[model samples]
Target: MADIEPYENALDAIPGAHPYPRTSRYHDAEIGIHRQADGTEVRYAKRRLLPPIEDRTGDDTQSHTVRTGERPDLLGRRYFGDPGQWWQIADANPVLDPRELTDEPGREIDVPLAGHFPRSPQGDRRG
Candidate 1:
């Protein structure tokens, strides 16, 4: 028998982990998932509408910090060219306060990419 390593977040295990940003236009969303006849699980992909990117890095921008006010929809539009793509950003950063738009300034945090794909309801990965 072979020992298997426990699964962990790639970014969590490594310091300063920065994955390449993905294009929201190129993301395939799962509409549904099911087990195949061979006992293999498969996901059904659907073309989804992504949100827009809203860069709040202005004079009020905090240093090395991610603000809760940074709307994913806004970001989707700025980065992926659509406001509907906000879910992708939300899915990437679940710790963020979706309701609150602004966070404490000067807090270190992760900035989700256009297609980062968060597991939140907005992302809707159940499909």
Candidate 2:
């Protein structure tokens, strides 16, 4: 005779199962960040005003060109002191492309004010 054990049906029936595999606070400078269920967007909090970027363009080769449009990763290394943190800078500026960070002669994107860039519904800062 062979011994057999009963089979478990639901996932909850299994022992040692944790509910949340990951936890996040979602702390963004922008307040309008929230989740969408069906087709409508719901605001979680009031939008926070971001500091405007100071126009620091000097009398050089380029004029009327946006400076915030520069590569984010490089700016991250320079500003945040972390190259990996580039996405943070990029997220704050949706007009710029992430891949273009390494592109020579980077494209001119509208410089975001020093203030926090609006986060997308998907949580990605990319335009």
- lDDT per prediction? 0.43, 0.40
The TM-score of predicted model 1 comes to 0.31
lDDT tens string, model 2, 22-124? 1111333234656677757765644433323342232211221325545555665665465655555444333356765435453443323332334434443
Estimated TM-score for each candidate: 0.31, 0.29
Q: Model 1: per-residue lDDT, tens digit, 1-92?
A: 02222332343356533222123333334346789899998765444543332323233222234455665466557655767655444433
Error of 2 at 39 (Å): 30
Q: What's the C-alpha lDDT at position 51 in model 1?
A: 37
Residue pairs with colliding backbones in model 2 are 50-115, 51-115, 52-114, 53-114
TM-score of 2: 0.29
Count of steric clashes across candidates, in order: 29, 4
